[model samples]
Target chain A: MRSLTAPRRDPAPSRLSYRLQRLALTPMVRVAVRRGLPLLALLLVLAVLLGDADRRAVLTDRIADLRMQIQQRDEFMVHEIRIDGASDLVAAEIGRALALDLPVSSFDLDLEALYDGVARLDAVSRTDLRVRPGGVLEVRVVQRVPAAIWRGPTGLHLLDADGARVALLPRRADRPELPLLAGEGAERAVPEALRILDAARPIAGRIRGLTRMGERRWDVVLDNGQRILLPRADPVPALERVVALDAARDLLDRDVAAVDMRNPARPTLRLGAATALRLRNIKLTELGVD
Target chain B: MTDLYQSQRAMRAMRRAAMQRGVIAILDVGTSKIACLVLRFDGPDAFRPSEGVGPMAGQSAFRVIGAATTRSRGVRFGEVSAMQETERAIRTVVQAAQKAAQLRVDHVIACVAGGDPRSYGLAGQVELEQDHVSEQDVARVLAACDMPPIGEGREVLHAQPVNFALDHRSGLNDPRGQAGQMLACDMHLLTVDGTTLANLIHCVKRCDLELAGLASSAYVSGISSLVEDEQELGAACIDIGGGATGVSIFMKKHMIYADSVRLGGDHVTSDISKGLQVPLARAEWLKTRHGGVVATGMDDREMIELGGESGDWERDRRSASRAELIGIMRPRVEEILEEVRARLDAAGFDALRSQQIVLTGGTSQIPGLDGLAPRILGQQVRIGRPLRVSGLPEKATGAAFASAVGLCLFAANPQDEWWDFEIPMDRYPARSLRRAVKWFKDNW
Candidate 1:
């Protein structure tokens, strides 16, 4: 009795589907599903990939291999080293102290550690290490000028103005042009000794060297074995006073054994033993008792 | 009575909440179609002064963002006859509108066109205690009105104060702060069947919507279809709906009377169906396509094919002239209009300064209704369409959507009602704390 070919369909949604569509359209829910789900999935994937110890180790190894490849590029590899402002002997010493293998990558080279190593060389005062553009580690070294040669009980050594030991010498004759210093702590007083030598320049030709007495004062010795005992304080001015007396009265040319200017207020000269007995006989003849 | 008062106040508070939230839905549950409109309140301050748009009758306060309409099911005489079927229809329209808006609407303002609305006029007078009238005096005057027996199983839907008079001077819109000895007020109260109202509330609740406000469709259609001057000068709006014809009288911009007739366009369609021996669907199609209130000489020559799905060749291949269809529809349309005219006459519409009558709603689209309406409703009848609101779809701007558009304007700026005013102090319990406070203020 009814026409069933084209049935009327209900367009109204079911309660469940209606509620679900509303839930999906909710702003908070929509944003969570849109943005938060992908980020959470990414984190889950990363966690799965990196969970095993073997995989982690392989990943780190790959990273290290990649780093090595970048470091070993042609532009980064160090092929040569140049040391400036140093003698060949000091240069070789610095090279040995550095101990870097040749043709190593500049990335593998720790310039700060190499700088510390090269700076510790006894002959170097200051050293700068830098990898230049041409794959070279250029070390610009300022060699320590031996301001004074210290003669110790062990051997002879070169001393700089700041009283730092530069290098050991074979003998005193090897560096005869340098002023010599001798005492227990004579290297520590190199600058003061040099200053005393500067003030004693008036008797420059006759000066042999300066010795540190009690490691506090300087004893200036001449070529004739005559000594000037300088004071502990203001030794340079005291030495200058001794040089002024020697220049004015030819004090050192006479038979003076030593000049003691230790108190700075009084300058006492001790005559030689023979010259002292002759001076006493002259005094006795003058007093009429021969 | 106080229970319903409190509930109405609660609904007003919900409306405020919806406004604060900036989005509310308008549901017009008519006999033939259920329309849902999503309104987004941008507030009055959203408009700039230079835009040249002032808040014109509160229309500028909100915009219609989404609109949808669906053929109503299981409804008769504008009232839901089948609960599940009506609920499904509501869900369909609300879902479509929400989809268009891309928003979730929780609060709704709905209009009811069925429910057998009845109007009452009440007047009360009170001697002014002080020389100048105060808000409390106005409240006391409204409270002093004599209560009429509105009959059992009926609930008051709208109780609006329509007019106020100070001393001998009448027609005072607001007597507050005015020097007067006697304050007299006129109130308009509209009531609908309690069971029908409750059924509507339950139906909306079943669709997961909170009813923020409920209004009679007759009142709201009058609000949208009648122009400002027409309302000011007193006019009657006849809304010819599918199963009911709503009649409302507006005077001084307030609805003074409202009633609904039980006859409407569906009766005309049934008449056509019985006269031509066609299905209701085909009859409805013929009524809309070739129907007219005033048939002409040319209509007899134009044949309208009444297509059918019946297997019989004679039943399937049938034809009728446009004049025959018009003849079948005109008597029923005249009957609905005569009923509306009788209701208007009973409401003393003839005594008003203006006898303007506006015919609107789905059935008002019948061809040549304007020519036929004036014969029954008077010589001043004219068909009206709903006022244009911003962002409303072109298809929804018809006379059928008059109540829907009026619901939008109502949500933006609702009229003051009896419950909106504070209860008179004497009505409070004797030992109430506020009463004690009032006593302390008066004697101190």
Candidate 2:
């Protein structure tokens, strides 16, 4: 049912008017689209690249700062050192011993290793090394006290409590007040016997050198060279009985070359080569009987 | 063909036959080096295990026939990496030692460092056939311990029965002739990677030596380094080698656990090289000459010259301060200690009654290490040297050579190995699954 006839239209506008409209709108739209997109994309790329470069710069700067800080810290720490309880060690000698030729300010000293090296000296028993907050080095040393002086073929060496050879005492006008040990195996035997003697210190002063014969028996020599032959069995009782006899009869003062305590019950005394005194069943209580 | 039981019997005979021989060589395949020691056990009186830590009765008795060491090759973290290189190194050290001893040997006992070794504490019970227990019964009770599924590619390195618990009584060191209806055993099974074992055995065979026995390097090191009391109670040995550091825990004179850390002295040297911008060889030399963990004030001004080869006047004349050297060395040492602390924590070192920690090995020689180690590793730290052995060179007695000297003592008096006695594998109890699960839960 569509209408077959079309309606009439007004006359077309002039070419001048059409050209004016096109001229007014085309360049504006083109400029808006073209300028906006490229500018946005360029801005985004530039931002991303700048961000990456900034991050790299920040990381590099941080690492450089850390390196500087470490170097500064090391330099700052190198100046603080304190030495404690080093009276016995000469400063020059210690420096020489540690092989330190650099100036004090330039030397990064390892106090503990230095302490260990110092402790390696026979005279040093214990040592402690510590660093204070300011990088000051502090060292403390405890010198070993010689328990006895062992006279060997090599030289006169100082012995510690455990019978370890400590050092050779310098021969001078003033020597350490320690007991002297002599004989072939006296150095080995004295330490062991001294441990036992230390347990019995009340009478320890009366004895001097202890000589072991055949590795089983021991001969205790008095300070005045009186030999006391100790029995193999029950030596403690024999020692105690001798102490009692000496206390009661002053037998140590007798002109005797040797006293045999082999039999705890029967004590024998050799005053001289020909004169021998034999006392049988000399019990601790028998001191009053004599 | 021998059945399983007959094969076990024949294995026992073979063990006895190996023991009767006079000389046995022990090779300690450590990450740092391969050491071979040939020992001659002069009958029963020559060596006796101590009752407790005191002066050992005899000192001048044991004879060291010969010893030698070579740089370990093809070993990474204690496990054999390249079999051929390891074999060659072993052959070189063993041949040199044999020549020194002027004797040819066949039997060899060796110790390895790595294999992801795991330990389990197992208890087993058996009713006595008689009223009183016998040595046979003791052996039977030990054999009754169910062998847990050791996993594929793994073999038992050490399966030692540590303690025995008789019926209504416990801590019975020896249960023979004791009256008990039930005997329970506390056994420790140490398992290592089977591939590692095969490689070690192959290397020994290629060197033309018979396998007398094998021990864990950490176990033997603990045996030689720890005092008797420490071993009887409990202790740990940390052996810091050039390539790796080994850790072992001992209780009741037996190794309860062992482990290794891949970092060691080599890491420290590398850190120095990178920090100082020096060559590795120069860094090592500097580390040995001037390295210290704790820096002192005097170190800042101490200048060390860097030898230059390019003839650049400015670079050749340049010097770095001592404090700078310490700065490079401290952090790496601290990291090593921290790693060791973490390992000890994992091993439950704090739970031990006598928690003695002994430090040995080449890296332990660092300056101020003893001081810094105790602070990081907790209390009870000591620097350990090998127990003074007869005829050992003075240079070889330091902490660096603990494993070498320990191998000597181990070869002389070998503890019972896993294959020494018969193990009834067929009668394994089913409850071992639950035990293994429990161990996994506790350890992992």
- Model 1, residue B166: distance off in Å is 4.8
True contacts kept of 1: 0.27
Q: What is candidate 1's local distance difference test score?
A: 0.89
- Candidates in order have lDDT scores of 0.89, 0.71
- lDDT, candidate 2, A1-290, per-residue tens: 34455855422223354334334334555576689779989999878876887787987899998876765565445453344555444344444556644334323566667776777766666777665556555556666677887777787888888777777866622454566666677677665666545533555677775666565666777878788887866666666667777789988777788889877678888775444434333453477654
Model 1, docking class: acceptable
lDDT value, residue A45 of candidate 2: 89
True contacts kept of each: 0.27, 0.00
lDDT of 2 by residue, B1-444 (tens): 123234334434543465576666678887667887777656646554443322252322355678887877788778889987787677678766776776666677777777777777777889998999876677688777787887887777777777888898988877889997999988888877878878888888777677766667777788788877888889999988777787889888878777777777878888877877777767778888888888889899888875544356776676788799888878888887888788888878889888789998888888888888889997899988778766555666778788777776665555664345433433445848866765686589
Per-model TM-score of chain B: 0.95, 0.84
Candidate 1 lDDT, B1-444, residue by residue in tens: 988998999999999999999999999988899999999989777644323224577888888789999999878998889988888888889889989998888899999899999999999999988999988899999998888899999999999999999989999888889998999999999999998889888989988789999999999999989989998999998888999989999999999999999988899999999999999998999888788978889999999888898888887888989999888888888889888888988989899989999999999999998898888888998899977777788899899999998898888888899999877877888658978887787789
